[model samples]
Target: MQNRLITCTLLLAALGGLSACNKNKGGKSDVTGWNYNDGKKSSGFYVAKPKDIKTGPGLVFVQGGTFTMGATQEDVMGDWNNVPRRVTINSFFIDKTEVANVHYREYLYWLENVFQDPQYEAVVKGAKPDTLVWRSELSYNEPLVEYYFRHPSYNYYPVVGVTWKQAYDFCIWRTDRVNEKELIDKGYQNQNVLKQELNGGGQDNFNTKSYLMGEYQGVPGKPKKNPLKDAQGRPRNTVKFEDGILLPDYRLPTEAEWEYAALGLINENPSPRRSEKQRGEELISNRQMYSWKNDGYDNLRATRKGNWQGAFLANFKRGNGDYMGTPGGLNDRSAYPADVNSFFPNGFGLYNMSGNVNEWVADVYRPTTNQDEDDLSPYRGNEFKTVDVSGGEGNLRDSLGRIKYVNENDSSLRNRFNYQRSYAVNFLDGDSLSSSSYGYGITTLISDKSRVIKGGSWNDMPYWLSPGTRRFLQEDQSSSTVGFRCAMTHYGAPEGAGSKHKTGNFFPTRRQKR
Candidate 1:
């Protein structure tokens, strides 16, 4: 037994010596992706990527879900329109109020000042106001014609007589301005980049992520270096969209988003699906029509829950044949303009969705939309930038065969699709029966057509007050009845740590129903 123990000890010692010494038989290192030299391993420790994004101001996260998009309960006789269709909508944002006269004027002011070139100047002037809307047939709106747009007093009211195309331009202009300011505030010194260039150049220099990562300071020419070095030991900027910077292409709301927001329906119940069993306390509630509930003056219903004396929530004609309000008491079209923040806000903390100047949405007009469109981000139209022929144009192909035009000016080259001009082209190519094999729906359209408007106006009757009612006009046509609002798409969950207002308490909660 003593002899065996002595042999085992000697074997163990020999193994230990082999481990200490260099034994290179094949010569390949044991480490596949790591290298250890001078004490530290070359590869860094693995880290799971960050999941939730931190959001900043300017984004209004719209909670989305399925809803009866049109009028569910009947208010008028023979009103079979706006059938309740179950559809889901993804989250997005929208401007809280209609674009006011002051805001529109700001856009016009910029356009006039910047693009002094003759070609652009002509187009801008042609799109100016149709001031004749202020002229009442029987009474005097002459004062309004002269003073409504220009007067400092009327600045807060919704801007009227602006075309749909002009409104779109304003949105684009706003995006550029907002991004430009953001870049300057971050200390980017390139004034020439923000300046108006004929084509899109030097614009790519602005990055939202690098700014958030502390790489780009607001001061000019002082971009900081990232603390964490890359594989080569050189610093690298963080990925884009890591910071909550939204590139400004804020558009008008889609018809679906508008209707859903107008309803102000939210998820009150903790239940995941609407089909899940629900308690009485879990149901989502209804929203009223007025900015506030029933008031005396314009009150259509008998009972009134609004403020004292029935003051106007918005500017409008009161009583029968009273286009203007009572004498010496601001006319129907009187009161110069009230402050933008004057009125009561709705359930979602949005002001004047109703009884403000009507707003334009991106939907093409259709009676049976709910029957078709996908619930997610319900929108109907998209006419992006046309293909530039000056560059090496790729061969355009159709399902049938390769498409070739005689010249660049050929209408086929101008538009990608060859769908029918009718409004039936609601869904994408394969999604609907009314698919576009030939042209776009708007391509063949003529007259005052394209672009849809929403919200009731100060000049409209009670029936138009519902959020679901939709109407459209040509992109170039302007009207006193029309105005607009802006919106941006939200990136994540609506309620987060960054939310300032106690969203849960201020607004009623929603629950899925069995």
Candidate 2:
């Protein structure tokens, strides 16, 4: 026994030396130390340093918390759809304000310039807002129809007349633009790459997935020293995603995330000790009717002292025919949708969460989603797919220069134990014999095309201004009273360290030996 103990001690000492030697002269881990090389030849392997996550432009981090999702006030509509339920939301970054007319115009400008071909012209045109949506049969809205989006005066207003599909496409475009700019700023690529003219429109666009998969390459720039060496000790020519340089893809906020953010209940619920020890004891004080300080709907005045004292809290219809307020003393100040940042922000520092244009969320419409969804970070829509390997070179690019993906099939996923199905889009709402009994189209108006729209619009009454009040619209249909904001998943913690929440550690804790 004494001999065995001494042997173990010696082995541990050797491991300590091994760890110290694995670090390079610069104090970074050398990839070679990980024993990653195959027998074939010398290759590059990167040990990426963790990067500081910079908040994307126009975004506010919504430090997530537990809250009762659904109607906070009386269900005046009698829908019973939004039955209150407890749910926990994960922290995520969201646009501080709605996407404005100027933002949409920038997207359009890129579309027009990149996709100038006759075949792609239709694609560009489809992205344009339906200006005619502003027109009404009785009202003379001709001026609004022509000028709402194009006029400089309305440039800062939340963009409307955009379909859910169009908003989703805009998110994708924004992600690529932001990431491409990041690479350029880091000197990984040339600054003039964005300026280079391509013959096939979107075919040469910088899609994040495509670029990472080695399927797309921009204009050549000053190449960095590749860690992987060839037979002759020459550097390689590729950049891998493991370098931790790219940002995550932006998407529409899920239904639970949106509702949780809009409520911004964190300010009302104070946790003296935010550790796991006190998690269950954190108490939510007053239930909110609007995204504001008071439970009363009529209390629109700013509680804090400043120039904002007695100012309206949000932009919405006060009563029947009372859009703004009487004459000179306009209550909410605007008859139409106001500037995206006009009103006071919620507890999460997000503007117009309760009133403005109703925003589209990334949820398939289902009245029963609350009952069936997971308590933690609840969401409804998910469609599983795998990278297509049929072309032999698995990462083969299609004509559009995007990596191709196919729905997972039973034969290909034979050994997988967790998932046996190809698609999960309608996983919980399709057939009775399946996991979920809620039927789509056949028994209800809910279909794959139906998407959830949350918050209230400028045309909406006070009842509709509640954050929990949800409605549905077809994905392809545009609406003058609806708009959207983008969201990005938070990579690390639920409550970001040094943030207002001051709760749990920002990263995973190392497991203790038993």
Candidate 3:
């Protein structure tokens, strides 16, 4: 009541605007007769049912469907890793272009500013991409090591020398930053606090999970702008995840999601044409060898009679010592990784899915995990963790000011209502109790730490260009050939299209025999 009276401006327009009242907002509760978003002492269950979530920036929505997720072409290298198997992928959003040098530099700038204190200097240094990855004992590419990352000339080029772990960390930072912006935009958080934190080098940096879990108590927005209230109709400042404001965590795309996206199979369907009652024919008879077309080992170039006739479509080595084609007719046009925006995009309007640079994905490299993994959204690198909230409201957090997660192991599951098996990285694939074949650092270099790298790099051969073909490297190790892109899990309808032009039939719920 004190806050309500204090905000005389909002009080004047209380009847018109959505001001806090002792009643529900509008919707009646389905479970109970009581109302929702109601500030009443009897029932104060705030609920937010947004029509649809805002798609994250630079993301292209890839519709979910069943696809043959393994090698479409002959595995010439004789690595029986990616065997052909039908698997379904859930709808998710992926970055339209690979993470470029400019994008990464922005992240580094933030880290440098925020973690300016001497104690946090290691955080800044660790985030920097390995610029020295460009050096090779045989090659004279010394200039690239100095200029590639620092120079503005390669701003839009894909950021290489980023390890799988670094790429993963980048995604975590991105999630907090993106969500922080969202809160600021909605007037839930004070926008000036961001600049203040940067300048002051404050440890109270805004993190999405920390904010939601009541860990970080940063500056709140104006009272009138917030307009939230408690059960007693007093002003409530904090925003919750249930309020439908914050976004899902931005993370590395799972290997299945990455491959499914790389293979832009949408163009293969006859989706351009649809009927009144029924939609277009949902069919893909052929498995795509490359991201460009269904054809195997053909001229993947501009065959149409125009200025760009016979131009190379992707960046890949044609043969040994063939980085670029020739002096006059430089096929693929790029000797090294090309500008991310310069590539002729695949059918999904996603650039450099087949080349430019190989990408880091969220998966433990197991040769036959696909055979045992779940058919729906198949993946293998799930080391389950719970947000550690040991001290009630005050939770343990990282240097970035996010919730410090406790590994969801068996012993930690004592007081927990829910459960997830922890450290399942090599559970069925190469565990001591399970299969003893592919011994880590012994029988094979493959280990739980070996993360999957997808899509062929600029120096890679045509055989590696296939979406199904995969390779792996140690998670901590960085390479000049490797880069990464981020992905976000999609909520609501898989179609993404709303009710108006929705495809497929929605049958009525079956009456339960009481």
Q: Rate the local accuracy (lDDT) of all candidates.
A: 0.52, 0.76, 0.79
Worst 10 residues of 3 by lDDT: 13-22
In order of TM-score, best first, we have 3, 2, 1
Per-candidate RMSD, Å: 15.8, 8.3, 6.8
Runs with alpha carbons beyond 4 Å of true place in candidate 2: 1-44, 197-202, 223-238, 269-281, 294-298, 303-307, 391-395, 410-417, 434-444, 497-514
Compare the candidates by lDDT and give the number of the best one: 3
Output the worst ten-in-a-row residue range by lDDT, candidate 1: 397-406
Among these predicted structures, which one has the highest TM-score? 3
Which segments of model 1 are wrong by more than 4 Å? 1-59, 72-81, 136-139, 189-220, 224-248, 266-282, 287-319, 323-339, 383-448, 494-514
Which consecutive 10 residues in model 2 have the weakest lDDT in total?
A: 35-44
State TM-scores per candidate: 0.64, 0.83, 0.88
When 1 and 2 are scored with lDDT, the better candidate is 2
Candidate 1 residue-wise lDDT, 355-401, digit = tens: 55677887765545566666666666644222232423232222111
288-311 per-residue lDDT for model 2 (tens digits): 888875533335567666777777
